[model samples]
Target: MAHITFLLVVVIITALAFDFTNGFHDTANAMATSIATGALRPRVAVLVSAVLNVVGAFLSTAVAKTISGGIVNDGLITLGMIFAGLVGAILWNLLTWLLGLPSSSSHALIGGLIGAAWVGAGLRAVDFYEVLEKIIIPAFAAPLVAGLAALLATRLAYRLSGRADEESVTRGFRFGQIGSASLVSLAHGTNDAQKTMGVITLSLISAGALPTGSGPPTWVVLTAGLAIGLGTYLGGWRIIRTLGRGLTDIRSPQGFAAETASATVILTSAHLGFALSTTQVCSGSIIGAGLGRRRAQVRWSTAGRMAVAWLITLPAAGLIGGAASAVVVHGGTAGTVAVAVVAVAAASLIYLLSRRSPVTADNVNDARNVTVNPQPAPASN
Candidate 1:
């Protein structure tokens, strides 16, 4: 019984750690454009994001319900299984963070839970139908729709502003970007933070601390919400650099378009109980915003690498989760101890490494252009 309780503690702690990483790692999704376009200063942008995120966490519990019961069989999930699953997710998140890839921490957690459940309790432990209906279908659709919307919106904005003075137009759009970016931040918290809350809720349920199938409780919501918001305040400068700089230059207009697009998709997904990837949606909008410009360059190589990372995150984390679950079931208390040791070592190492290549607010906007050639081929030449 004590062992079970200990595992439950680990699962909750690990889930919060993942939530913290999720906040900083994905902050760029909502506020990067605002920062890039000078719509909001770095400090102001994060502050807004943090506050909106906290408020957003209270808006909807539909996604939380989906998570508590949708991805894995809540009944089959023991506290040990939950702990093992979180281990897989935290490792994947750290790995992607080091590479400066804006991969989906949400998907990592889902994949881990699915994998651990499958390994520990067999294939019957999963609900493939719900996973497909909820996660898989929305995963493809959300980003594409958001990206196209931003593309059309960008085109319209440029066409309307063609006769305006450049400085005035940029200034006007900067103001608009702040409002839209704040919406995206709030939308992000509503969607992203809830996933962690659901995980904790699921842990509580499996441990018999809560009912078998219920949405995240009030305490779960508040703590997870605050943890993620705090992490957002810290910010994910490496990813902010990659997003704000790497994926085509983001101007005030582009920033406005991207934030608008991201907000639409994120809010829509939350309403429908779909667990969409904000990272992918934001990246796609960034790409789409680039395409909206006539001469803007799209670095397909960087995008290609990101696509590969997305393709691999789920299955790779799943394998780790499955293996971890197997050892956890066999070794019991000893395995829990080992998992703790590994978690500490891994977390310490990643923190030390990040300190070496520290990306701060000062250098977060430094452009790392991929193309050497300045001009592009004419469309109708």
Candidate 2:
């Protein structure tokens, strides 16, 4: 370990903050279907997901290595740039959450880092090839694969149970959802939590606290795990409603297929060191699951909105990250302080606005809560 600077401290804390948001934002990825199907109560689902997330964090560090060394030239960047990137990621996560959109938290973090690196150290600092190879290609491919798999699995599940008692089949599938959803949660920890570990490790390397290319230390893994686990326990009910009920009306069979497909895809990507988006994969699976069930309707309107959010996640977060980098890199301590204050203010505003029409474990499954609705103006005669 090398000397830890104040800026380094800020970067690590910000990275963990981003990780916390990642947990809640992507909680729907694992537990949404299960909750929607009543396989588990909302609070219980999140609690189970939260615990699996912590345990999954200790499973692997391959994705962490990729973040620390593969995407950008850590040699060319500084602690300020990293902090700026984290700020961008955090803001995007919060904004999308407020809208009940299941955009990609993984992409937000990657795009922020890319934009900050490009601004701070010029284009040379960003490895475009690695970005395309590791992040871009997988982003498009993984979801489609998961969706297709879920579709097939759902079809097969129904076919096999066609002659069985409908009530018993639904009940059995619901029971199975607990296990499948748990696997997705474990997979979520393996992939998403490692991303924060990677970011923190990158900051450590930039600050000379760890040698370049070193993986996250023990403390980094533990803290990242705990932060995300806590966030998972809190849950993101707004997004959960969007995924669970908005995208499609999920039954136990469809929920089981979706969760199984999502878990398989996410776990495979984590092993291969691809920082894929669990949100996208899970959403795609839900859509597939909808298409598989007879007479089930996939809401393209809500899906369209979600798709647009996903398409813009990278560039949107990048622009914010680039702008933030300019301020932090050019303004010194005062600049960092200013960025922090603005971020806090913005986050607070989102939180307060969310409370005006709050979604919680209690009403997360209500049909009216399918999407995040703005508060209705007072009625006038």
Candidate 3:
């Protein structure tokens, strides 16, 4: 009993650490375009994202419930398995952050759970059908749908406001960007923070802290929300640089459209208990918005890199989690200490590397070849 209690505490702390990374890692999904377009200052944009994230957490926990209930058959899962899964997710997040790849944090977590569970209790531990219906189908579909929506919204915003002064249109849309970005942030909270909540709750379930089949407790919700909010404020500028300027050139109107599209898709997914990847969905939307402009340049190399990252995220995270789980389950307390030491060392190394190539608000805008909200060059009729 004592061992189980202690491990549960350790898992909770680790889960929040992962949640913090999740926040900064995916913050770009909500604010990258706004920052690129001067719709909001970088600091201000992240602050709004942080707050809305907290509010969004309260919007629903259907996704959380799915995570807590769906992916792995909870009856066969143990506390060590959950811990191993979190380790896998934390490691993957750090690796991607170092490489400036905008991978899906949500998928990493899901994969970790899947891998850990499979190792602990074999294939029967996985609820493949539910995983297929809820996670897999949307994994392929959400991004395309989000991108198309963004493309159409961009076309509409331009068509309706085409007659307005270029400066006026930008000014008006900047205000609109704030509102839309807020929605994206809120939607993010509903989706991302709940992932941690689900993990923590599952940890509790594995440790028998909560009765089986219960959603996350209020305390669990608040802690998960706060961890992610703090991470959002810290801001992963490397990821932001890749997203804001690398994938696409975001003008004010396009930024506005992309954010609006992301918010709608994510909110709907969370409501439906589908934990969609904000990184993928938002990145796709940005690319689609870029394509909406006839004269805009879209960078295919960066997009390809992101797609590759997406393909590997789940399985990579799972393998890491599976290995870690086996060690922790058999080795006990010393193993826990060893895992902690490894995590701290890896996190510290990533931090040191981040300083060498820092990305800030001033430099973030400089990364792009284009500036905010330019007049589209007249096309040949």
Top lDDT hit: 2
Clashes of each: 0, 1, 0
Give model 2's clash tally.
1
**Candidate 2 regions off by >4 Å?**
1-4, 61-63, 66-69, 211-214, 368-381
Per-model TM values vs. the true structure: 0.91, 0.94, 0.91
Candidate 3 global Cα RMSD: 5.8
Which numbered prediction scores highest in TM-score against the true structure?
A: 2
Q: List the candidate 1 regions with Cα displacement exceeding 4 Å.
A: 61-63, 66-69, 213-215, 369-381
Candidate ranking (TM-score, best to worst): 2, 1, 3
Winner on TM-score between 2 and 3 is 2
Q: Candidate 2, residues 142-218: lDDT per residue as tens digits?
A: 88999999999999998888955678889999999999999899988887788888878877776778897788899
Q: In the order shown, what is each candidate's alpha-carbon RMSD?
A: 5.3, 2.6, 5.8
Candidate 2 Cα deviation (angstroms), residue 189: 0.7
User: Local distance difference test, per candidate?
Assistant: 0.80, 0.87, 0.83
Candidate structures ordered by lDDT, highest first: 2, 3, 1
Query: What tens digits encode model 1's per-residue C-alpha lDDT throughout 1-381?
Result: 786687888888888888888888888888877887788888888888988988888886665564534668776777777778888888888777766788888788888888888999998889899778776787778878888988888888888889547899999999999889888888788778878888788778777888877778888888899989999998887777777777788788888998888888877776675668888899889888988977888788778878888888887778778878888888898987787688779878887777655677876776553121224562422
